[model samples]
Target chain A: MFDYLRYIRERNFPHIWCSGCGDGIVLKALIRAVDKLGISRDEMVMVSGIGCSSRTPGYVDINTLHTTHGRAIPFATGVKLANPKLHVIVVTGDGDATAIGGNHYIHAARRNIDLTVLLYNNYIYGMTGGQVSPTTPRGKRASTAPFGNQEPAFNISDLAEAAGASFVARGDVYHAQKLEKLIVKAVQKKGFSVVEILSPCPTAYGRRNRMAHPVKMMEWLRDQTVPVAKWERLSPEEREGKVRTGIIVDVDKVEYTETNDKLIESLKADK
Target chain B: MKKKRADNICMMQGNQACARGAMMAGCRFFAGYPITPSSEIAENLALSMPAVGGRFIQMEDEIGAMGAVIGASLTGLKSMTATSGPGFSLKQENIGYAAMAEVPCVVVNVQRGGPSTGMPTFPAQMDVQQARWGSHGDRGVIALSASSAQETFEQTIRAFNLSEKYMMPVILLVDEVVAHSTEKVVLPDPGGIELFNRKQPTESPGEYLPYRETDDGIPVLARFGTGYRYNVTGLCHDETGFPTNNPEKIEKLIRRLTDKIERHRKDITHCHKIMLEDADVAIFAYGSVARSARRAVFLCREAGIKAGLIEPTVLWPFPSDEVLETAEGVKAFVVAEMNLGQMAREVELASKCRVEVHRLNRVDGRLITPQQVVEKVREAL
Candidate 1:
């Protein structure tokens, strides 16, 4: 049994997440994954932006930076480049990662920088009172979309894969144990890795989407999500609404900081 | 860090001087986007940073560049970013974050004409008020301006020193004239200059408080990944650096964040009072316009007018005391700037109706000439 409580800031107790918010669950799985790797707490740095999931850094005891909205990835990029030895992790949400920050997200992947992005796809902007987000399913209800969201939703994992991330995976809060394992692999990958967690925002998202209870949201995850191995076997019609829950892409690439370091060294040698 | 030159005297452009001056000031991280009139600073740093064993990245946009600078600064590096008007607007949110979080860093805005990318390659002293109150919120700021390439070099170093000492972002504003003009500069020996680093906590990690108030009102920021394990946020946070909703705690945090900069205005403000000792008419200016103001002062004196120039290198914390003191002797002030009249309003407030304030305005992407200032002074008289 891992001593997860030791990793949290006890003084910040009574965490900010609502009774059934899935952010807490993602936080726990993240702690367990780091614990499994035997990494020192001091060696970890968590950077987050403004969102319900961005609050994850405040609870855990590590070098955490909660920055402005939609800028966590770039901040984390700086942190990683500043000290390549430290394992930098970015905790963000669907809107925070894909909307305002979409450019940075794609650019970081394109550069193949070493960062583990634990993106919480809650399907709505929960922190700002359940506004429509980039990941909001078409016809989903939101405060800004009371008449139902008119746009198609983004497949976040696919975006990361297309953007050239070295590692990409998806998991749900309902499968807590499996999610922890996936996070471990994403963190181990050398270049821009993304682990998109299908977390629930019970208060903001679930209530309006016909699953008001946290338990129902978890059940929705269980029923709608299929492992990628299984998902690949299903027909196109059979996979209409089902989400794939496993690694979609994993490959080796030249990490940005390593290349930067080499360039500095080569310049020094020439001098 | 390599010395600027063997003899320490060289002719360099204003942007080159700024980048080299930053190296002397121990800036180890730079992230910026390419914008006209300020792109040379980034281009110079891209070559210099790698040579000096520092880091540089051309970010995707202005906001991300500002964000990266803050993050790099938190990790105990003196980080900076340079941009122009449009980019400066995009960086305002993160600049506000640096203020609220008390992260020490530098932002250089090479003044270009703008309400919106109005003129990229030309100079304007338009961002004076914006530098002071650009970021939305009630927070005090420190901004410095330079009249020449040499002064831009020295002021860039001073900007970093003040930022580190005060634990906040310092804005270094240079106009397009100073940024692009080639001038002779005697670079100071790196060892001969003074530099200030952010205060490090002497206390153990267990006893450390990231936002604990000190005698000077500045809080010590522990570098990230150095066993401090502390949290930093833009939300109103208490001494522990965690967000709080208690009205009293929130108020205290806000006041402390602001008072740390406001209380030390004397040390942060820098200005040049040229020939103001005995003058009936004083010209108030800064940036490249200050060069023209100095010439106008000399021209006024030759023509039997007791005229002087009050050039504020530090534009914010607004030099009101200096203005008030100078206003006692001068009959009136001729405010010259490339903008319509930004600093003129500040001068009027500082003078407190003791002297009439006259304006010499220009916005056609041209530097205000000495003749224009002389005419304005004569007309006011």
Candidate 2:
């Protein structure tokens, strides 16, 4: 844990994230995961796109890339393919990952490259002052949705599973230790892995909805999420309105780099 | 790997020759998509890269391809990406990032007709302007246009050298005709060729700035995993690689980008000057059209007309000084290209002297033949 603290930029402490904001919690969980893996700090590369969650790379002490909006996955893919020795991680928000950059994210997962994506889903664009995001619940009030958000939110775990990610998991900020454990597992996995952390935006989404304090947001998260194993035991009615937090998908597949290398070798052998 | 002395002669397309050149130049990584005329380059790289312990990746699209090449270059490997006009357009943004980050990489744009997918199978040099201003911001680029398969091989080697020397992207502009047309080429002894690598910083990690300008206006590039802690960004940054909005810093940064090529103009720029000693008629051309103009110049001189050809090998810097000098006493100049009069505008800009510059334009997706150039020169005369 002390070694992991070296990766954090102490100058950026007391981050701009509002009190009880899920982003900080996610960041902490990520750090703990890195520490648990005992990966060399110099061998890590953190890439991010433009958004509140994307700012996570700026606080890390590794080879950090803060790229344009919604382009972090491609950049992370490039970094991984370039040097397979390095551990590449992407920290992106729902808007940055699922909206404009959705194409790249899906294709990257389809290839199943060795990359770990930490998606901080706060249900709104926190940096741009809480505009309705792709994951915002329908009928939720946002700055852009004065009345209520009418668009259907995406379930990221399902999307990752469908896109061929070898490892997919979801955890809320309130479940900090569980999130850390899942992140560690994803980092250790040898193919495309994504850990969706449902974070709270107290200032924007929480305050506006009158669940303004950190304690109330934590209470809501604790009550709204169910464990994945217990999810099947619960009746459909009981699980109807809750987010399931656990490793939803884990399987083995040939990674992109390894497959490409083998294909090239076979072609050369035939020649 | 050490280069061995050999003279292997073969009849191959210009694109194949480029692939051979890249292999000889120690390029171990190639990421590109298949596009008309330029697909042969990618295909050949796919077959040849593995033989030399290299890798080739056909990415999902040109954007990802170019990004992969940039990423590979940062790993201390020579890397390249090949594409045509539309694919080239998709690659421009990342090319700009490579430039701003001082990454050494090569981009080959085998030219084709296009506003959007104009001619897939046909030939055109319409991307001359895009090669200069395709990306968003102002940055220096080194572009070389090859006239034949032999030059294609030679220029590809030079492209790698320039990319490494300047820590910037070097464009190899080959029109569709030259790219696909077969010609007998004599392979040079690789042992005799010169290769350049990007200069590494001598300063300590804390003292180094990724974008710091040297006396020659070129910055030193440190490969990733070198413990150089220097930041790389697309934004306007100071020498230390930190973002800065200072007007003076921005001005100096842009100036360095421009001046690095401009200040070394004499040494970097290359062009062919023929029969300009006392010639009254000149034909300015490049790539396939330049080859046609060379033959036309011979025909014109035989007909008692003092005609000459100026073929620009370095396209981006425009070879302005040579163009101006070569056009000094000429009564008329004919600019022939496989495009809608792109380089003709540059010739007009350089040759400020009132020489009647007639353009022999061709956008019909075919090469501008020697006879057509001869006729245009005769008409201008």
Candidate 3:
């Protein structure tokens, strides 16, 4: 068994998440994936924006940067471009990635920079007391949306694909073991890779919706998602609310830093 | 016999000189969003950086640009970003974050006419106060200004130096006239230029404290991949670089952020003074307006109204003591700038009501002529 303690800052450990919050599950999966890859903690930089999920960096003992709200992708981009040797991973949430940071998200994908982004989609804003988020399902109740959320939810994995991410995948906290595998594959890929994990904000999101208990939220995740292989066999009508949990898009492209390095080399040769 | 100019001397635009200066300062990374009157700095670096094996990224937005600069700086690289008023406003939040986290980076703001998108193509010295107080906080700020292309180049290098020394963001305030103006600059040899880098901890990784206070109150920071696995956040953090709610620790951290700069005001403050001996009227100016003020000084003297000029390259930490001392001998001050009256207020405060201060302000997006400062000086006397 891999020792999770080696990767975590044990001193800062009375973790801030609620009992059933899936942030912990995602954190553990991320650690397991990193440990399996055998990447030294020193070479991995964990950059995060403001959210409960963003707090994951503080617990892990690597070179961590807790940056401003919605700016983690740009920050990670700089880190990667500055020292391509460092493996830059950005941890962000639905609101942090899709709403305030929507432009950066799409642009990073467009550049196809070498970044592995682990975005936690918790349906609602859990940090600032359960506000309606960009990923909040239409007609779901929230603090700001006392009346049901009238806005249509975003399919983030599809958004990444449309934005030109070299690799895009979806996973859920309920499928923790498989989620680790997905993260491993995303980190192993070259250009911009996005792994959107459907995590539960149990205290804030679950309490407002019908699934107040942590187990209930887990069960809901289990019911709403289908394996990619199984989902391909299902008809459009049969796939009503079920999301496919696997790689949605994967293709090869020249990474941004590599392209930039080539340009530098060509200029040197010309001189 | 006449002397020959060095082959390195060339007519370089202010923005291009500034970009070249960054490269000379060992800056390895630049991230910026295009804004009017300041886009050339980014454009020049976009081409020039690749030649030098440096990185230049045009980010999606101003906030992202600021964030990227800070991120690069933490990786132990000298980094910078340039912007105008509207973009500067968008960058304030992360600028504050850099101050709090003690990241060393340079932010260049080319002053333009504005409360909003006031004047893109025109010149104005409106960001003087904003450079000092733009970001929300009690954190210390160091801002430098330049009146010519040559000065802009030199100050760009100094901006990076101060940022690295203090481990905080330094603002390089340039006006549109200076940024776009072309002037002759004899680029210095790399060996002759003085540079500064952030202090790294000598302690082993286990004993390293990224925020541990030294004798100067500035903490040494370790680069990310150098085996120092520490946490850096915008939150109030302790010496170990992890967030803490302890009031004493928070108070110490906040005070040190400012005290580190304040204690070294002598080292950080820079002022350029001209012909004040046997003068009755002194002209206080900075950025491009100082060019007119210098001409006005000679014009005032030709008219037998003895005059001199005080041009501050370092605008913040305001050099109040020097101004206050100069105020004692001069009977009056003529404050010339492109804004309504930003630095004029500072002149008044520095003079402490002892000497009469008159303003020569222009907000019509035109230069304040030498005659205008002569008139303001006459009115002040």
Against the hidden reference, what TM-scores do the models get? 0.98, 0.92, 0.98
Could you tell me which 10 consecutive residues in candidate 2 chain A have the lowest summed lDDT?
A: A9-18
**Model 3 regions more than 4 Å off:** B1-5
lDDT of 1 by residue, A1-271 (tens): 7788889988888888899998888989999999898889898999999899999999999899999999999999888888889899999999999999999999999999999999999999998899999999999999999999999999989999999999999999999999999999999999999999999988898999899999999899999999999998999999999999988899999999999999999999999
lDDT of each: 0.92, 0.85, 0.92
Q: Per-residue lDDT tens digits of candidate 2, residues A176-268? A: 999999999999999999999888888889877878898898898999999999998998899877989999999999998887667667867
Q: Is the docking of candidate 3 incorrect, acceptable, medium or high quality?
A: high
> What's the best-to-worst order under DockQ?
3, 1, 2
Q: List candidate 1 segments past 4 Å from native.
A: B1-6
lDDT of candidate 1 at residue B263, scale 0 to 100: 87
Per-residue lDDT of candidate 2, residues B274-375 (tens digit): 887778888999998888999999998998888898898999988888888877778988999887788889999999856878999988887788899888
Q: Identify the candidate with maximal DockQ.
A: 3
Worst window of 10 by summed lDDT in candidate 1 chain B: B1-10
Docking class of 2: acceptable
Residue clash pairs of candidate 1: none
Residue pairs with backbone atoms closer than 3 Å in model 2 (clashes)? none
RMSD of 3: 1.5
